[model samples]
Target: MTELQDTGLRRRADDAAPSITDLIDEETVQSIAQEAWSALVGEDEFLVPLPGDLPEDAVSSWVDVRGPWNGTVVITTGRSTAEQLSRELLKEHAPPVLDEEDIEDGLGELANVVGGNVKAVLPGPSALGLPVVGDAPVAGPDTCRVDLLWRGQSLTISVQGTAGALLDQ
Candidate 1:
């Protein structure tokens, strides 16, 4: 008869997953956003910490991270603000008539930059998914969200875990 002894390498199904707070905080997120804005949006653009209510027509863009920590980095702002950002991103190349595709592309790029930075602070060897624009994903229990204002416009960034894993909370 073969004897088996426990090596304690296995993890429980509900093993506590690492939270965003454990890896990074809102200040780091804001710093990353600021850098992205300065480089991509404009040289003088800055993000303020003052919180404001998001408009009913708010739009969001996000990128998913899969690794030791799994979640999404989402950026949300009003539609008009998105348009303004898109214009800034395109700068002199912006068309007179801003289009939906332009706004999404700009927002997606912002999310990618911020998401890539956020991923860097996490456990590492993580893969970032292509950006997606739409409603923000449902926040998990360990989600870490940050609110910011840009040119008096309300905007937010969130890092949220998987929905199924949220139930473990």
Candidate 2:
């Protein structure tokens, strides 16, 4: 695990995308189910120390953002949360319950939404890969993260770049 500052990702005057810190703060950092907070939590409250890591569970998803520089955005959830969310996401599709397959899709979709939005900020020339299931750690190169809290749960937003690029650019 490394901090972005250590990687020293400086933006040249000609660069279009903002620095990793700025990118995370302005784009990826957000409350999970913010719109539904009121309905679920009954007060539309934002989680404290919000913006935490989104851990991997039985069901989780992610999206990829690419451009002149390559990086990734990951979203994960706890296994229990996956089961609960799976019920909602697959109840109808499976006649009142979600199987492993349904949960997988839900996980992927969550990652996709978050990942896609982030990738859009970068130049269109790059490519973002599909989301996977596992507790992958993101901490290397130019990376920034926001820890989010929702009813005691944490959703981590990790952005890693400089993963592979100009070794000394």
Candidate 3:
């Protein structure tokens, strides 16, 4: 091969694959979560950035983003926290007793909004999948997570690469 071609190849090889840190930071993630919280969970509700112990019965909701960056935006919180959040989202419309489905749907929509905003900041032209609620996927190497507290309840938001580390382009 010509020396010019070899040099071009080397340059491409030197570029590292994009990780979560390369695209967004924890502060940015926290900001995105805060926006979602203020919009949906009530204008008065705010997410504190302090780290806290998550309850054993924590529940998670997430949405997948596929494109230059492939990962899931996951939101996790304790069961009672989730219920309170759902009620807050519904405001006076919430029933006297919140059911499991209500909690899941409310949290799922929160994930959708946060994930959509998160996707906008990432290397884009990406597609966002519907939100899923349950256990969160195990965090991978190229992951960005933010610990938060709402009403003094522990919650977390994680952006994890589904395909592990991104390989060189």
Candidate 4:
């Protein structure tokens, strides 16, 4: 009879991919957003934990986080709300009439700030990608989403793993 060798390596389960839910929770995400808003938008600005209907012309800004768990942090709201946010972000520097570029830049900055904070809370040594503005990426099963209202306007924040990340696991 031959003795079997003891290999230290262990097999990983097929569903071993880390999910957003496992890394962070909705309340944490909301807190992060609230802090970002207070700093960028205004000290008195608040993000109410409530759901509202998103308008037809909804826009999104997002940043990708790459690390042990890869995913995107996205913020979505109506175009009008975005414009209002841009104005608030600009504050004293805001022009009477904001152009498209202004709106996009403001929204992108908000995403970058929120995404950076989210990245800090996750398992790191993670790299944060530059913010992108457009339609939001489709969220996967491994996601933590938060619905919020700012000034009674609908807004949402989602931390979701990419489809490729899920497939690679």
Highest lDDT model number: 4
How much is 158 displaced in model 1, in angstroms?
Answer: 0.9
Model 4 clash number: 0
Q: Which stretches of candidate 1 lie over 4 Å from their true place?
A: 1-19, 162-169
Better by lDDT, candidate 4 or 1: 4
Determine which window of 10 residues in candidate 2 has minimal summed lDDT.
Answer: 32-41
For model 4, how does the per-residue alpha-carbon lDDT over 72-107 read when each residue is reduced to its tens digit?
A: 899999999999999999999999999999999999
Error of 3 at 109 (Å): 0.8
Q: Which stretches of candidate 3 lie over 4 Å from their true place?
A: 1-19, 162-169
Per-candidate TM vs. native? 0.82, 0.61, 0.83, 0.83
Per-residue alpha-carbon lDDT of model 2 for 58-152, expressed as tens digits?
Answer: 23355556566566666556776655554554445545656767666666666665666565545335567777666663534536555666567
RMSD of 2: 7.4
- Candidate 1 per-residue lDDT, tens place, 1-169, comes to 0122457777577687545565567777888899899998888998999899999999999998887667889999999999999999999999999889999899999999999998887654888999999977664543767889999999999877754322222
Candidate 2 vs candidate 3, lDDT winner: 3
lDDT (Cα, tens digit) per residue for candidate 3, span 62-112: 998888777888999998998998999999999999999999999999999
- Residue pairs with colliding backbones in model 3 are none
lDDT of 3 at 165: 41
- Give each prediction's root-mean-square deviation over alpha carbons: 9.0, 7.4, 7.5, 9.1
